[model samples]
Target: MDRKKNISMAVIKRIPKYYRYLKELAENDVDRISSNELSEKIGFTASQIRQDLNCFGDFGQQGYGYNVKELLAQISSILGLDKEYNTIIIGAGNIGQAIANYTYFQRMSFDLKAIFDINPKLIGLRIRDVSIEDIDNLESFIKNNEVDIAIICVPKERAQGVCDIITSSGIKAIWNFAPVDLKVPNDVIVENVHLSESLMTLSYLLNESKITE
Candidate 1:
């Protein structure tokens, strides 16, 4: 596994929260930022920000603080957003098509390169600006274009098989939205996104808070 990819996967998950704070700082014209200040803004402790920043090599001065521009650049590089990543989404169902039409990644540093489905009806259809491609074309497309990541939105039963095919096609990273947990080789990185789990967590928090009132 590429160490850069490993570090990036961890840091990319934090970009939104960090970016929000940085954007506020930029609006306020705050130049130098201590880790503590960054922490307060993001609801993390100053030491946590310092430690996370240290993972990509020191960016903050011992006494002063981190230069906003420098720190932003470092975080950007670590998250692998300095360059664009071409992504393929498997399964052209509702969620998949929704993701295809989403403008969030286009506004950020990622691009939705293609979509795949086994249904012949969907094979020729277009989602967003990108057209849906048959699963049979996945290997050729990935090989020819050098796709960086894949999104697995297929049914839980088919998720593992799709991931296997993706790995064989040379994609190293995956964003799996299936309900089941997937097993992959060490060389492949699978990020499982269980929306139900998140919603349940939120529900639990709200219920707990309500009891305290």
Candidate 2:
């Protein structure tokens, strides 16, 4: 497989959607699908689908289309779902608890190894069999464990502090839920899930639709 590097972020973002739709096709026992057929199901233009996939490698044949099962496996590997990631949540608040309770992440190979919080009452509590530890133990725990991702769900005011500890401990990736933007070394990757911003974006789209109508 001839894979290209520095692929645009727009294409990278669409890869997960392709993986999801391809998984559905595979689950239904669909053996093959042309770009146009996948386009109809996935809401992307056939040419766009072809172009996006070409960034990775030549996946489809001229007449044979794409093998559903094979494509799904390739996309899965592309998304790094083929490997296990040990994850720790740095806050045991509502968002943190909700994330911990979600078992689907484990299904995708993101293992929740621990949860940390400064709250005395939340300490020693377990969510999905993972005990919540005191924040003071965060650095030591990371040192002892091979943590691949750190989730920052602490309040905005404390998010950066928690992030500093995580990055300092050599964690390369972070899934941040705090509203504030975090600064980190260039090598560290942060994916922010700002709920309020998402809601406001929805609100804007709703108003725009009303105006257009």
Candidate 3:
């Protein structure tokens, strides 16, 4: 199998925990580790880890294990954290401002390049060095710039429309924080982060705990 196609986001997401555990092992001078050992430390079944790794071809020997440093580098590159990605923000609201303020976004190789909104008051404003432009300028700006990702922070009612505009603007991936479900084209990737649902889940957990008590 093609190595790039073998490593997926599902497997990539688990790499951090695995890398942390491997780092600990490396600190102890453990040069190699078995699948079973990784499974034990990360609470995954040995077979599952093996299956994920199999996508990238067999990295372990029968009795020996994987090289910690090599596996870490492989996983890091797969997650795309090894290079910087230029990002744009749709909506210059409070939530959008907060995302712009996030240092981890830059630390993780995501650079905030610009912001967009329909509000005339916000248009031409600057936040964190990225000027807020009129939403009408989205297509031209995105086309001329190197924006690879869009962060949607618009109101729930406007989410879908805004997303459609963003997709039309040629952004392939979106990190959406709007309350509404976005309907974009098939080629576009939309990741919704519903804050209300998360809060409701916490509320349900608190209620369930009270019942048990």
What candidate 3 gets wrong by more than 4 Å, as runs, is: 4-33
| Cα deviation of 24, candidate 2, in Å | 0.7
User: How much does candidate 2 score in TM-score?
Assistant: 0.98
Q: TM-scores, in order shown?
A: 0.84, 0.98, 0.80
* TM-score rank order: 2, 1, 3
RMSD of each: 3.4, 0.9, 3.2
Residue by residue across 52-170, what tens digits does model 1's lDDT show? 66656757898899888766666667567789889999999978887788888877767998899999999988877898999988888888897988999999899999988888888
Error at 120, model 3, angstroms: 4.2
Candidate 2: residue 32 lDDT (0-100): 99
Give lDDT tens digits, candidate 2, residues 10-94. Answer: 9999999999999889889999999999999999999999999999998999989999999899999989999999999999999
Q: Which stretches in model 1 have alpha-carbon errors above 4 Å?
A: 1-16, 27-29, 209-213
* Backbone Cα, N, C clashes tallied per candidate: 0, 0, 0
Ten residues in sequence with the least summed lDDT for candidate 2: 160-169
- Tell me how candidate 2 scores on lDDT: 0.95
In the predicted model 3, the residue pairs found to clash are: none
Off by over 4 Å in 2: none
